[model samples]
Target: MNKKLKNLVKESYNNGQLDQETVVYIAARLSRKDLKHYISLLKQEEAKHEVLVTSAEKLSSEDVGKIQKLYPGMNVIHSVDKSMINGVRIVENNKEYEINLNRTFHDIIGFLSTHD
Candidate 1:
């Protein structure tokens, strides 16, 4: 993680939002990583948007990459969503993903987050 991101996580940790173990995990997970490390910024942005991602969503590292790629400026928290067919439901930038397919895409959470 870069200085800015490291600081943000520190701030969140200080605020008691993020835990130390998670911090250590993040540092180790993002070690020697560029794009993966940038996900911290995206995660921080999600907190700002009031969208929670721990209500049963299962976000994988690959899914995180996919969400970041689809909405580069948005932070997505993955969980087990039982409502959508298969896709992300994002709630960021005051706008949502415009996915209109009906093939059970696994990116609905990226959209549901917006509706909420």
Candidate 2:
């Protein structure tokens, strides 16, 4: 039954007619457990690459636009963290790019420790 539903979802998506009505109809036919599994599978199939930006303050529209341009096709989720101090940290697909003052300070401390 799950396999049948998987195939149906795949076919429907491929046919480009998997709309809200079709989703409601399919969901109505699924058991609670099956619905959860189906939704997870669907998410995997239609997963959008995400870019998460965390900063001490909210980014300006221009800054957000620049970030979006750098990571085209990715869904950006911005958040604020006072601990960041300044600058922003970008996280995408489990990879992190830190450009915050706190991180820089930490890096400098680590470097000095290693040198001394």
Candidate 3:
């Protein structure tokens, strides 16, 4: 979990040369606690960056394409959530971008309440 170890893991993973020998070489250096932490970090590092596009209904090809273009080299996953009513919510890198009917309604209600 130190910077150097994290960088080494990232570099090894990115290099696509993280074979068994490389794993053992790193594993051999760590204590049990560090080994567990290293494994956790490795799993996180190896996970593909994902973009979750949730909407009330399936999006058009054009919309999906636009999102894909926005996030090249990352996975784009789409899911339907009827409660969204309409519009889309995008999740990328732990950040959320939403423009949806539910959000709009909530905002309107909040504004009306504050002014009332």
Candidate 4:
């Protein structure tokens, strides 16, 4: 392509408004003879940016060590709950395991039998 068209493309791409894939897509439309070059560039850029929107919560080294030692074959998917309060509840491999803090709380366990 000519210098003017190349400059416009480079500007739009570097501005980050249009990602590399979109830039290459426009390039392909304009440069039918060199579409293969743009396609390869698009694939490379896409691979590099695929993880941009995919991020997980950070886990500390201690946490990872604990998981490796205790859970063996388990891979923890990071998550949170608003009602988690001060403790954790783990649902692993289709089984529910609840661990709760016993502070400033009331439990009516076996109350019916004792009161009657």
| Candidate with maximal lDDT | 3
**Which should have the higher TM-score, number 2 or number 3?**
3
Model 4: lDDT equals 0.49
RMSD of each: 14.1, 3.9, 2.9, 14.6
Candidate 4 lDDT tens digits, 25-111: 576566665565555554543343322111123446686566556565444554555344445555554455655443214344446
Error of 1 at 53 (Å): 7.4
lDDT score for residue 38 of model 4 = 51
Rank the models by TM-score, top first: 3, 2, 4, 1
Error of 1 at 24 (Å): 28
Model 3 lDDT tens row, 17-100? 456777888889889988888887776664547788999998899999999999998789999999989999988876899999
Displacement of residue 102 (Cα, Å) in model 3 is 0.7
Poorest stretch of ten by lDDT in candidate 3: 10-19
Question: Against the true structure, candidate 1 has what lDDT?
Answer: 0.54
Choose 1 or 2, whichever is better by lDDT. 2
What is the Cα-based TM-score of model 4? 0.35
lDDT of 3: 0.82
| Candidate 1 runs further than 4 Å off | 1-57, 69-75, 98-116
TM-score of each: 0.30, 0.62, 0.73, 0.35
Error of 3 at 17 (Å): 8.6
- Please give the clash total of every predicted structure, in order: 24, 0, 0, 0
RMSD of 2: 3.9
